[model samples]
Target: MKENIIALHQKNIAKGAEHLFLDKGFNLTSISDISETSGYSRRTIYKYFESKEEILYYLIIEGLDHLVQSIGDAIDSEQNFLKRYEAICACMLFYYENYAISAQSVNRFQSNAPLNMTTSVERIFALGVKINEYLSIWIEQGKEEGILKESLDVMPTVYILSTNLNALFELVTTKGTYLFASLHMTKEQFLSYGYTMNLNSLLKEPTK
Candidate 1:
């Protein structure tokens, strides 16, 4: 029961951090803000987190864990390598489109690398490691199945995919309308165009 209570307190603090960080922007938010927003005492917050950066790291990990779960489920449901890859893209877009604010926050963090707190930088690197592992596993599977070309360098391909996806999300969350509105493209439509190009370039043709 004591452990259960501690878990609940930790979760409450994390929830508060998420709300305040998103609402006030992480840079502008303070512990007082979280205390007022979450109704958790400063002592309680400190009990669960070493600092504000720790709280933000918790939120980032929470978001990444959720995305990994969704992507895992989507990829598992598909038998075809290419289809699994497509499901990966779909799950990614679903999360971004639904959580555009978080996406925007991530974009800001990426572009403002100098402003990154130690905890946030470590957390992002941790997430990058997870992404690289996932990309490596899936791309290797595709190679063995002959759906990805045999000559593909897995790391380079992974880097290319990750880099472009970040750029795509940044654009869609910011300056999307200005960059794409002239072409009468909605964000989803624009994403589809990007996704299609990636697939065409990455996937090997089925044997006749």
Candidate 2:
């Protein structure tokens, strides 16, 4: 069937694109390259995607969905706020360690893409707000249980902590990976650092 053939071609193109994006990044990859790698003709490639930017957009969406799912799965069983936070960190580290090229490609896409750039930025900002809302709920629960600081503004604190974790991971992944494996310039290090910092900042009780 024509539909079946199209589906197969689409799958192959996606696979090839993912490989090239990770290995060569967005700017370096070309339509011809995708055609050769995917065993599809240039015409077929154009039929599916107008340009490399479109391809990058699909990859970004796919990667983010995977990342969100990974984090969701990691925390499904944990009830404690600190433990859940650690689970999130664990998921992020796992992605970085096992899918470094894909992860890096995603970061590059977010930072460099021009088409729909403002829209993409807005989407990310909305996602951050949603994440902060969840963090607020989690912290409020912790306060009710007499575990977290009572005076903490649930939403603001969540936003601050989440921002800090993201920045720290970015630093570790970009510059710290080789400074002794223990230093966690890698994903694992970032996760470990997250746990430590969460325990220090969120889990610690205020003294009377």
Candidate 3:
């Protein structure tokens, strides 16, 4: 079927782009590179994506969706709040360590060429809204259970928590570098450091 072919092309393009990104990063990989690596004609590549940036955007979008889903599953599998938070930390740490390149690309994907395209911009915004909704639901559950502070508003709290967690992870893993390095720490090391900070921040009272 035509749809199946398109799907196959899209998957190939994604894999090709990811390979190039890991090797050369977003700024270096071109449409031609994607086409050649994917073994699709440039015209065929364009049939699936208007531009290379569109491909990158979709890649990042789908990657984050998978990340969010994993986190949701991890939290759902746990009973206690602390254990759930631990599971959440574990999930994030997994991505931070294993998929660091893709994660970093997401921040860049927002500012890149595809994001400026109206249709792609709308899709990115829609995905953000969905991601925020997931974060809000997670926080709502935490709040309802009295683990998260009672006065927290979902949207702002989710934004704050997500941003802070990213920064905290960056601080630990980045060492002294300005850019967060995906290579510096093992997953266990990063998780231990980041989770300690996370659990400490969540506490209403500090233990001596």
Best by TM-score: 1
RMSD of each: 4.0, 4.7, 4.3
**Model 3, span 14-79: residue lDDT tens:** 888888987898789898998889898899889999877778777766667777787767656756
Candidate 3 residue spans exceeding 4 A from truth: 98-101, 108-119, 171-190, 205-208
**Candidate 1, 1-208: lDDT as tens digits:** 9999987887788787777666778889899889988898888789888888777666666666667777767656756876777688876776676554445555545464576457666776667577677878888988898878898999999878867876777677778879687989887788878777776677787331
Ranking by lDDT: 1, 3, 2
lDDT, model 2: 0.65
> Model 2: which residue pairs collide?
176-185
Best by lDDT: 1
Stronger candidate by lDDT (1 vs 2): 1
Task: For residues 1-208, write the lDDT of model 2, one tens digit per residue.
Answer: 9999876766678778878877887678898889899898999888977677666655555555566666555445556766776676766566656655445555443355464655544554454444445556667777887888777777678667755765666676676756537663655555575568655776556322
Question: Candidate 1: which stretches are off by over 4 Å?
Answer: 97-127, 205-208
- Please give the distance, in angstroms, between residue 53's alpha carbon in candidate 2 and its true position after superposition: 1.6
